[model samples]
Target: MNKYERIKAALNFEEVDRVPISLWMHLSENDINPKSLAESQIEQTRKYDFDFIKLMPFGLYCVEDWGAQVQYYSKSNQPPIVKKPGIESIEDWGKLKVLPAIYGTYGKQLQLAEHVSRKVGGETPFVQTIFSPLTVARKLAGDRLLLDMKENPAIVKQALEVITETTINFVKANVNAGVDGFFFATQCASEELLTEEEYKIFGVPYDLKVIESYNKETFFNIAHIHGDKIMFDLVANYPVNCLNWHDRWISPSLAEARKRTDKCLLGGVREAPYFDGNNKKIRDSLLIDGTVVEIGNHVKESIDSVDGKGLILGPGCVIDQQTPERSLYAARRSVYTGAHTLV
Candidate 1:
C-alpha cells in the first residue's frame, strides 16, 4: 500500500502492508518564510519517505498576531521563543482582536500548508499542527492565567471565545488547503498545569469546538495531550480518530493507552533525551540524542505493544532540528525489518 492508504488503514484498524511511519521537527532557519518552510518539510519527508507530513511552522505562530512578542534566535537549530506575552493583565485579555486566519503568522503557515499540499498531491497524508484554544490563552497570559480563570472567569471566558472562533476559522482554511487532519496539541492539559475540574471547564469545551469544526472533512486528526499526568480519558474520548502523548516518558504506556482508548496511537520515539515530564528545565535544551539502534528499539517496542495495529511511529512531540536524519531513517526502516506478534 502507498503512504496514504497505509495511514487510512491504521486509522481503521485494518491490516496494513506495514505500520505507517512519520516524524517531524522544526526548521529554525526557514520557518519564517512559507516557501522555504514548505521546501524543508518536503525535503525531510522525502528523505525518510515518511507516511505523513506534519507541517512545523514557528511553534508560537498561533499567538503571534494576537500581540504576543517573539524573539527569533536566527540559529539553524533553535526555534523562536515568546520574549513578551500579549496579555499582561486581566484587562489585556479584552484587547485581543480576532485576527484574520489568513493574516500574520497564521497566514504564513497556511501558505506553507498550501504549498506542501500542492507538492505532495495525494501521494502522502499531511497534517497541520494546531494548539488548543486554552493552550493559546496560556501562551498569551503565562502564569497569570490560573488566577484570571479563578478571579475573572467571565472575562477569561470571553477571551477564549475569541480565540476559539479564530482557531475554528483557521482549521477551516487548513482543511481547504488539503490537509488530511491536525496534530491538535494541548500544552496546558496536564496536572502540573491545571486540575481536572479546571480543564474540564476551560480546556475541553473550546478544544472540542476547534476540533469538531473540521473532524468531518479530515481523516488523520490526532489529539496530542502534551504532558504527563494529563487528563487522558477526557481528551482521548475526543471525536478525533487518534490520540498521541509522551508515552515513553509519561504515564500509561502505549500498551496501557491501548486498553483505555480504541483510537490509533502516534508515538514511540522520544523528542528529548531526558524529560521527566515535570515541566522542569533541562539546561534550556531539548533534542533527541538517541542512537540509531535505540530509535529502532523504540519502534520495535511500539509495534509490540498493539501488535502493530492502529499505530503511527513517531515521537510524542516534535523532534529536534539537529536530530540526525539517520535516526529517522532507522525509525522508518525498522517497520520493514520487524513485524508485530499479533495475538
Candidate 2:
C-alpha cells in the first residue's frame, strides 16, 4: 500500500499490508536549515519510506504570540523557553488578546506542510502538531494556572473556554492548509499534574470540543498523552481516532491499552533514551546495534504483543534533533518487514 492508504487504514482500525509508521521530529535547525524543516521532512520520508511525518514547531510560538519573551536556544537543545507565563493575572485574562491563528508559529508550520504536500504530491501523509487547550493554558500561566484551578476555579474555566475556541480555530486552519491530520498533544493534563476529576472537568471536555470540529475526511486526529501513566483511562476515552503516549517508560503495555479502546495506537518505543544520541547507556540506543534491524525488532515485539491492525510503530514521543538516522530507519524497516514476533 502507499503511505496515504497505509495511514488511512491504520487510523480507521482496519487491516493493511503492514503496520504504518511515523516519526515525530522537532523543527530544529538540523532539519530546518538548508532545505527548510518541512522540505527536509518530506525528503527524509521519501528517502526512508515512512508512512507519516509529524511537524512539531516549537511550543513557544503560541506563548510568544501572547506577549511573553522567548529565547531561542542553541541547535543542540530543543527551542527556547517562553520566559514568563503570558497571562499574569485574572485581570490579564480580561485583556487576553487572541492572536490570529495564521500570524504566529502555527502559520509557519502550515506553510511548511503546504510545501511538503505539494512536493510529495499525495504520496505521503503530512501531519501538524498542536497543543491541547489545557496544555496551552498551563504553558501560558505556568504553576499559576494550576493554582487558579483550585483557588479560582471559575476563572480557570473561563480562560480554558477561550483557549479551546482558539484551538479549534487553529485546527481548522491546519485542515484548510491541506494537512493530512493533526497530532494533538496534551502535555499538562497528566495524572501527575492534574487529578482524573480535573482532567475530565477541564481537559477532556475542551479537547473533545476542539476535535469535534474537524472530524472529516481531510483530518486524522491523534490524541497524545505526554505523561501520567495512571490516566490511561482518560486518554482512552478521549474523542480521537488514534491514541499515542509514552509507552516505553510507562506501561500496562500496548496490549493492555488495546483492551481499553479500539482506537489506533501510535507508539511503543522510547524516543529520548533510546533514539536520542545523548543517552547511550540504554539498550536501544543508537550505539547498541547501529542498524534498523535492532530498532525494528524492538518495535515488532510491541506490535506483535498487541493488535497489529491498529498499531503504528513510532517513538513514544518526538525524536530529539540529534537522534541517529539509523534508529529512525530501523522503525521504517520494522513497518515494511511486517515482522511482529519477538524473535
Candidate 3:
C-alpha cells in the first residue's frame, strides 16, 4: 500500500499490510524559513518509506493570536513565553480582540503547513496540530486560570467558552486549507493536574464539541494525551477516531489501549528523561547509555506482542528538537523491521 492508503486504513482501525509508522516534527521558525526541516521530513519519509508524515504546525500561536506574548528561542529550542493572562477578571474578558489575520505564532504555522502541503501535495497524509480549548485557556489564564476554575467556576467557564469558540474557528480554517486530519493535543487535562470530574466538566465537553465540528469525510481527528498515566481511560473515551499519548510514561499499553477502545493507537516511545538529558546538555552521551536502542527495542517488542495490528509506532509526545535525528531514524527503522518480520 502507498503511505496515504496505509495511514487511512490504520485510522479506520483496520488491519493494514503492516503497522503504520509516523513522526511529529515540530519545526522552528529558522527551520521553516530555510524550508529545510519540512523538506527533510518529506525526504526522509520518502527515503525510509514510512507510513505517515505529521504536518505539526505549532499550536502555541493560537494563544498568541489572543495577544499573548511569545518568545522564540534559537533554532533548536521550543518557543514558549509569558502570555498575557487576559482573564484577570470577568470584565477584562470582554475587551479581547479578534485577530484580523492569523496573527503571531499560529499564522506562521499556517503558512508553513500551506507551503509543506503544496510541496508534498497528496503523496502523504498531512496532519495539522491544534491544542484543546482548556490547554489554550490555561496558557491565556496562566496559573490563575486553574485557581479560577476551582474558586470562581462561573468566571472560568465564561473564559473557556470564548476560547472554545475561537478554537473552533481556528480549526475550521485549517481544515479548509487541505490538512488531512487534526491532531488535537490536550496537555492540561492530565489526571495529575485535573481530576476526572474536572476534565469531564471543562476539558472533554468543549474539546468534543470542536472535534464534532471538524470531523467530516475529508478530515480525520486524533485526541493526543500528553501527560498523566492515570488519565488513559478518560482519554480513550474521548470522541476521536485515534488516540495518541505518552505510552512510555503512562499505563494502558498498546494492547490495553486497544482493549479500552477500538480507536487506532499512535505511540509507544519514551518522552522526557529520555529526550531531555539529566544535566541539560545536548550530547547523546548524557542520555541513558543505549536509551535510544532500548526505546527502539521496546517499540519492536510492543508491536510484536500486538502482531503489528492497530498500532502506529511513535514518540508519546512531541519529540524534542534537540534530540538527534538519528535516534528518530533508528526508532522508525526498528518498527519497520519488526513489522516486516511479523509479515
- What would the TM-scores of all predictions be? 0.93, 0.89, 0.85
Per-residue accuracy of model 2 over 85-106 as CA lDDT, tens digit each: 6888866655555555776665
Report the candidate with higher TM-score, 2 versus 3. Answer: 2
TM value for model 3: 0.85
Tell how far residue 17 is off in model 2, in angstroms: 1.8
- The TM-score of candidate 2 is 0.89
lDDT of 3 by residue, 37-122 (tens): 56766786776676666765544566766767666663555555554554566565555554432655566666656776878768
Q: Top TM-score: which candidate number?
A: 1
| Residue runs of model 3 more than 4 Å from their true location after superposition | 29-44, 83-90, 97-104, 217-219, 274-296, 337-343
lDDT of each candidate versus the true structure: 0.85, 0.72, 0.68
Cα deviation of 9, candidate 1, in Å: 0.2
lDDT tens per residue, model 1, 1-343? 9988999999999999998888787888878999988988898888888889888878889888988899998678888888999899889988887777798999998998899999997988889999999999998888899999999998999999999999988999999999999989999889998899999999889998999999999989999999778888999989999988988788888999999989999987667666346966553222255555665666787888899898888888877777766766777778985532222
Stretch of 10 with least lDDT, candidate 1:
281-290
